[model samples]
Target: MTEMLAHELRTARAPISAHLFVSGFTYTGMISSWLPDKPDAACTSEETVSHLVERLEHGDFYILCPDNEVTPEIDRKRVAWAAQDIIENRPALSRWHPDFAERFAAFEKPDRNVEKV
Candidate 1:
């Protein structure tokens, strides 16, 4: 919904841009309370915010942040798969459906454990 709104606003009100900052596995008090301990893959809220600032400074319109668990490449693959879901006329979230699990796993395997320093 926000993405659609951003596009509409950008079209109607020119010269202004709306950016979306997407984060994964952020560690906060609420999240901590849900688990016995914080996971190593989760980034602290401060770290997430700092990265957001850095990306914004770099003029990134759509920022998909990398936590310890998920890297940028993996995020890109996921986004591409999501778009394919619509284009391919598959059911919503087919990636998680049992019938499509094997295919999704194959598509995601190349991205797994591939990260930058």
Candidate 2:
């Protein structure tokens, strides 16, 4: 996942949920390899989150959707919420709507059929 994280990013906001929306997104990958737990896991999660937060606070991720009013501040808030869930090591799986979970699962497929938003 670090490779994905390290992928060139546009001059946009934190993109906190970008990975989640992407297919094959893994929590352990966005992290640095120097944190805790088994040697196979962990990374600079703090630094990454901090940097993401900085961009998030600046409304770089601001967008409009059926569930949102398209405000930069609101986008930042949403990003913050998602980031905190990761920082606290919370299992967000149960919190996501089943529809989203299905979508994420489909992302792993070679011929994904999800439509562009």
Candidate 3:
């Protein structure tokens, strides 16, 4: 899944300086490895998206949307909600709607503690 997301990002010509792969949904290590620097950040989906948007506004880097149901067009509200969940250190999965959970289940994996993030 990580590889797929990375490939999509690369194909889209998004910047590679820094990127965030929202954890708690999928545990693909590719994004962590692709980052130019160590993975010093981890957050619920919302916080990650918020930071990504800030970075995008500042021209810090480009944001890549993983091929999930959360399209960028509808992600503004989702990102804000995710940001709050992350800041509170809550499990992102808990916030998903019932319909999304059904689709997201295919991507779930055992939680692996990342030593760096």
lDDT by residue (tens digit), candidate 1, 5-106 = 678877899666677989988999988778868799999899999999999899777889889999787788878888888988888988899989887788
lDDT of 2 by residue, 29-85 (tens): 433254334232222444335545665566544322211122333333344545544
Alpha-carbon RMSD to native, per candidate: 4.6, 15.0, 16.2
Question: Can you give the lDDT of residue 48 in candidate 1?
Answer: 94
* lDDT (Cα atoms) of all candidates against the true structure: 0.82, 0.39, 0.47
Which regions of candidate 3 are displaced past 4 Å?
1-16, 20-62, 66-69, 97-117
Question: Candidate 1: misplaced stretches above 4 Å?
Answer: 4-16, 111-117
Clashing pairs in 3: 46-82, 46-83, 47-82, 47-83
Task: Please give each candidate's TM-score.
Answer: 0.80, 0.26, 0.27
Tens digits of lDDT, candidate 3, 19-106:
4444223224565566544333333456556656776677543354433344443344445545655775756744476744643333
Q: Which consecutive 10 residues in model 1 have the weakest lDDT in total?
A: 108-117
List ranges where model 2 is wrong by over 4 Å: 1-68, 93-117
How displaced is residue 80 in candidate 1, in Å?
0.2
